[model samples]
Target: MSRARLSPALVVGAAISVVFVASALLSLVWTPYDVAAFDIGHRLEGPTAAHWLGRDHFGRDVASMILLGAGNALAVSLVAVLLGAGLGVPLGLLAAARRGLIDELVMRASDVAFAFPALILAILLTAVLGPGAINAVVAIGIFNVPVFARLTRGAALSLWTRDYVLAARMTGKGAARISLEHILPGLASVLIVQATLQFSLGVIAEAGLSYVGLGAQPPAASWGKMLADAQTLVSVAPLQAIFPGLAIVVTVLGLNLLGDGLRDRFDPRLDEER
Candidate 1:
């Protein structure tokens, strides 16, 4: 691995990721005001002394809602990413370490899974489970499984041929034990890089789920839900859509850049090339 050091892209990406992550965390303890409390009297009012970002049609403070919604989006995305990584990484390692039938089956299954997009999967899940945040997570996570599995398998395969791994195999160690002891450690940098990229995609998937009434429900205050609510009212009050849209854009872009930075910093292949 290359030495850990800051680049311009890394600094900017980390800054954006931190700001949004802090905003999400802050909502757990506090917001500008009560997000659920309605003040119809102030509905659609422009930004004022009391309402910094103005109030929506429901009279809920836009800033407060955005803050709360940040929490929703982040939570959903983070969980989905973790779910994918947790399940997919192990499968990849097992396939790589144990090859033969296991490798064939895992790779074939991943190809099958790759066929369904997150939105399509979400719709299928919503049909059976009903639309909710959990369904959105499941949908996004299932889609991500193939992504992580393929990447992990490819990365892990290289590690399997390493001198340390070949030596481990000579000791008559079981595949699982060898994978855990020898190969898993070597795959961390690749997994971390992939996780960051998937996390950004998860954010978008969560938002899209919420937008279509498949994720967070009413009063849950997800960024996508806010956009859905404000779409029709854009002519009446454009800022309603603008703020949440910007939130999604900035978050996704930052995560992508962060993933890029990690790739540049962590990829030994890239280092060798450079």
Candidate 2:
């Protein structure tokens, strides 16, 4: 197998992703300053020895808030992705294993789900449950369900026709057994790549939801909420918006790069072209 696992994209992406995760985890124990601490007298102060990234309108340490925000964003996105995969994978396997009315129904249901974007779902949830990070997770997770289901079903369908799968069938192994033994493993590479892409989307969606007051309540650091708070003052305190905005951009960029690298490394077909 062509081993491009350590390609430039992978190295850079991994570096960025590692930083994102490390900084987030670090915030759990320590940050430069208390993000919630407000020094009204020092509000909007320029970057100094204490505040590396300057201060927000409330004089909260920008760096500290960004650090905490990373944790919040990561938690929401990670849980949402897990929730989606947990439910979608099984449904997809079942549909692929028995491609009749069940398959049609599963796919049709996914289509219906696709009709409602995460924004709509988040809004609906907010109306009933009020806005919060947990609600954002559910909304994002629901949106991701059809994505994994479709990908799994497509990959599984092809695997079902493979010689190994046919041999397993001939050996009288049940569909469930054959799938777990033969089909699921084959889907891992593609699924991992898709999961990475979906993760980036999840972060973006969470930010969008938070901006509209449909996610991450007050006192909880969130990049989108930071952006929302900074909007009116962008012309005067551009850094307020710049820091969080850059965080989102860089985070998403790293994830997309990682997904692309993983796709290249995992897809053997690309070897021939190279």
Candidate 3:
């Protein structure tokens, strides 16, 4: 596709993703302020030369915490998406290839999983696993499994009957080999787009879980946790809530935009135009 023909949303989303990735990488090296350090005397201070994004209730620098929170959120969401895709794709391929009892069992189980909303699932898991980043990853990862499995199965089924797959079967290739070599490559574009969409959903799920005290615990800066902490001070410190909320909003928007653009790019009819 020609670069000039790319949608504006694609450009913006790519820029946003790059910005967040850079901020997260920088947080690994250093933050402008010690995110955990408390200076009660500086509490709720507006943005100033001293602190680019001001300070929170505990007088922690908002910019530094925001940067750290981006890293935490991205880590959980990315890992969750990877876990989901890893587990889901194989199950989906198995179901598609077997197409009998195995398919029925897997698809039915996915249906049962889909019944529970991500937030509810997070809360339930949190009760058993305890609140923390790991729990958040597990909760979101589980919620994502059904989505990926269903999407993969639906797409794989269409390709299963294609001429190439039939030829592979005629050549005595095993189901596993055909799936890995022939099937997976065909599903790459759709899966890539799905991954982007799922990453956004994972972020939203993690943030919601944290907001309700079921996610990343205190002392660990999380965007959702930051918003939760800022709630009580909304009247006096609206920036606390506003900044984190904007972070979530922008990140999700960017992922969605990128996913949409990818969908268009992978479609043969649309690709022709570019």
- The CA root-mean-square deviation of candidate 1, after full C-alpha superposition on the true structure, stands at 1.6
Residue-level error in angstroms, candidate 1, position 202: 0.8
lDDT of 3 by residue, 140-238 (tens): 898888888888889899999999999999999999999999999999999999999999888898888888888888888889999999999999889
Query: Ranking under lDDT, best-scoring first?
Result: 2, 3, 1
Best candidate, lDDT: 2
lDDT values, one for every candidate: 0.86, 0.89, 0.88
- Model 1 worst lDDT run, 10 consecutive residues: 1-10
Q: Could you give me the TM-score of model 1 versus the true structure?
A: 0.95
lDDT of 2 by residue, 1-274 (tens): 4674467887788788899999889989999998778899998887899788999999999999999999998999999999999988888999999889989998999998878876777677666877899988988888888889999999999999899899999999999998788899999999899999888888898889889998899899999999999999988989999999999999999988999888888888888788
Task: List ranges where model 3 is wrong by over 4 Å.
Answer: 1-4, 269-274
Candidate 2 vs 3: which has more TM-score: 2
**Winner of 1 and 2 under TM-score:** 2
Better of 1 and 2 by lDDT: 2
TM-score winner: 2
Give the clash count for model 2: 0
TM-score of each: 0.95, 0.96, 0.95
Q: How does residue 29 of candidate 2 score in lDDT?
A: 92
